[model samples]
Target: MSELLLNHLAGRPQAGSGPGTALSDPVLGTELARVDATGLDLREGFAFVREQAGAALRAMTYAQRAALLASIVKVLQANRDRYFEISTANSGTVKNDTAIDVDGGIYTLGFYAKLGAGLGERRHLLDGEAVALARDGSFQSQHLLVPTRGVALFINAFNFPAWGLWEKAGPALLSGVPVIVKPATATAWLTQRMVMDVIDAGILPAGALSVVCGSSAGLLDALQPFDVVSFTGSADTAAILRSHPAIVRGATRINIEADSVNSALLLPGEAPGSDAFELLVKEAAREMTQKAGQKCTAIRRIFVPEALYGAAAEAISARLAKTTVGNPRNEGVRMGSLVSRAQLAAVREGLAMLQRHAQVLHEGAAHALVDADPAVACCVGPTLLGARDPDSTRAVHDVEVFGPVATLLPYRDAAHALALVRRGQGSLVCSVYGSDPAALGAAARELADSHGRVHVVAPEVAASHTGHGNVMPQSLHGGPGRAGGGEELGGARALNFYHRRAAVQAGAGVQSTLA
Candidate 1:
């Protein structure tokens, strides 16, 4: 990276500062540039999106779409290193973490590409016999997964900006739907870079993929009935969007995946000094520190057996103490800064609220790594707390310090642990660590009603475990209540979000008679 690029990555003043104002990189800076809401040209963009969707649907066979997506995979592979560099620079994600996002995102595109190709070999609903009607005869019906004559609007979150945007866009495009992408300003530059790459590849039609770099003012209001809106962000924001008049009144298709207070449970069989005990500690710490703990799937709560609370707390704290927090570009830095100063502040506020019912088990605030410069970056070390009362509102459940932070909550028994996990209302994911299959299954079933995804970790699966902080393309990625009562990504389920279904009924005997 050049010096100018480095400065841009650091979000430093590019030019001389004006009186009482700074010139931080508008691209990677925490604060977003204010867009002129009224001046946005949605009409042209909307028309172009519609045109491209139609053209892409008409011109390309499903095999052609698959070939285009395969080309995208090759393009991404060639630029993988560049994406890692840019993603780390823009979002403070470490190289390995960013690599996972790139790899996972590429795999998602590959999956959809295969799906598109499969659509070609399958028989279209219209392929069946078409009946001719007699004097008083009526025709029967058929079902087809045709593309809806509308657009897909994607509103992505700051964390995993590239992945969020591409995951939705890939599937929608494969299903022959044009997508209008609106990435959160915190990391829009990375998304923009990726989109530019896609456009250069010439895979998508002219208006099949359009981007809104800034605000999306009046965008939702202009949507039609068959239009689809998929959002990935906070539950609070999802609620507001869910209530939009265009969506509610027009019954517009909407899919949401919001941040949730996910948890990890350590069963009694995993006592200290045992392999299972050690595995639990490692899993929790990894979830709390990876991607600087910005992921919605990160383990925010740790549920431990009452008898082993002290030992579990000590093990977790010791591991967290070893985490190296600094600039991601620095060698030996295991954990990087939070995405932005504002996000760091939000984490701090959540910590303050959590302190009301929890005691600090480990304090990384006082410790500093040699390469870290807090004054010049948004950095916070990993922190662990032991909740005084697991059932308390201020304890393990309500608060979500969305950084390298986790709260250890003690449970008297398996039943109590399951009850405490439910106090969070709904979570995107939850994990249980133990070698006992029966015990793990019971707890999993107990919490299955409240969590969207659950993982059982043991000696057998620990090595290959993706941990609690990862969401895959094939899985449903949202939960109920506090986690946003909507889902995204379940094969055809995501594609269906962009369509409307209506039943046409007639006499079947009349159709046969006419034939």
Candidate 2:
């Protein structure tokens, strides 16, 4: 075991294994750390957050809360080197991919800090103008927003340990609610380390931020009526969480961002070697290789026009062939292993399901090793498959191979492309590529009906546009239907989740006094 788990209620870095689990490195297949939160009192932890941390945070101005976030940013920046190394060792990601988790977390906090400062010191947020209840306006009602008197329970996915935690906690703290984070068991080391750092530095009040790295044993049982739970994972897990007694009874609020079969569409006019076509091919390969394609939002389906199907397949295969997979620490390695052996098994199972309808275009095979054993590491080369009959292929549309894998499908026209896009049921994001802005925008608009976000990658804007897989802090990150139909990280709009909006009915004198 590396060290004791961090339990905020037990005064940070609580010792003793006490029936726990070991976290192993995906690249080296060695024990990296241990997680055990058995001794923690869930009831007492919840109580401390509600009575102490919540009270202290509720009393502070938005500016003060933002200052706390800024302090957190400083600390994370100082320790970024250690975080990068941990990410490589534990998560099996290259420096570029690790930056998406570690530096992305820091950037999100910085964004929230500035946004919180702009919100000013008001404890209550006004919603529009006061409503008139009488002809003379003596009686009126004002809709105001106040912080929830409960904690935020975050059950994060394995792919993004650092980004997932801060993205949720930043808004909760700004909205005056405490946080209890439960990261996925496989790669919780990075999250545990960050939480320990925060607690040790006294960045926030005790109970304001806590973490449970192992099983979420008694955490959900301690939720109250006013609490909120944010989860990111598979659809099956989301269903289980949605059916919890507290959630079903409306005692707690649950927001889920589940797995999605996100798609990338190539317009008809773009030829094989054109800039738009090249961008589409490059982006599809990038999404597949980045983070070993473990991202929930990674493109699982690529839709190309029927004319460019053969060329598109060839181009994508070439890109995957050039990608280097092995230990992330090596300078030449472009991609790394999956998070663990279990994840590798899961990806292989998913690929088996996908192979029923699609033929392998590029079978991901490791060509070189960077001072690591191939059998021990959970590495998989980038794989691409071609699905000629996408209109009737059920597995290509539904089954998601969560490793560096993608399926290529062909569409006859714009209508056919849109049809295939909708076949995904719902997705977090989809992209359209072409030379004509007018055509691309119109098709993207049609595709947007089934996607949370649609990026129109015209040749003009392809250079500056963020890739299809990148999630920005300023936009909505969740989608409807199979994508979990929840919204998150829309800048200050995210703070709404932790606040309760109520309409106050009273006379003018009462309204004035309340203000």
Worst 10 residues of 1 by lDDT: 4-13
Candidate 2: stretches off by over 4 Å: 10-17, 366-368, 512-515
Q: Could you give candidate 1's per-residue lDDT for residues 416-508 as a string of tens digits?
A: 888888888899999888889898888788888898888888888868987677777777777887887777776656666554444334577
In model 1, what lDDT does residue 409 have?
Answer: 86
Best by lDDT: 2
Measured with C-alpha atoms, the lDDT of residue 271 in candidate 1 is: 60
Candidate 1 residue pairs that clash: none
Q: For residues 169-277, could you state the per-residue lDDT of candidate 2 as single tens digits? A: 9999988898889999898999988988888888898778888878787787888889999999999999998888889886698888997999999988887799989
Best by TM-score: 2
Scored by CA lDDT, what does every candidate get? 0.73, 0.88
- Report backbone clashes per prediction: 0, 0
Worst 10 residues of 2 by lDDT: 8-17
Give each model a TM-score.
0.87, 0.97
Kindly report which residue pairs in candidate 2 clash with one another: none
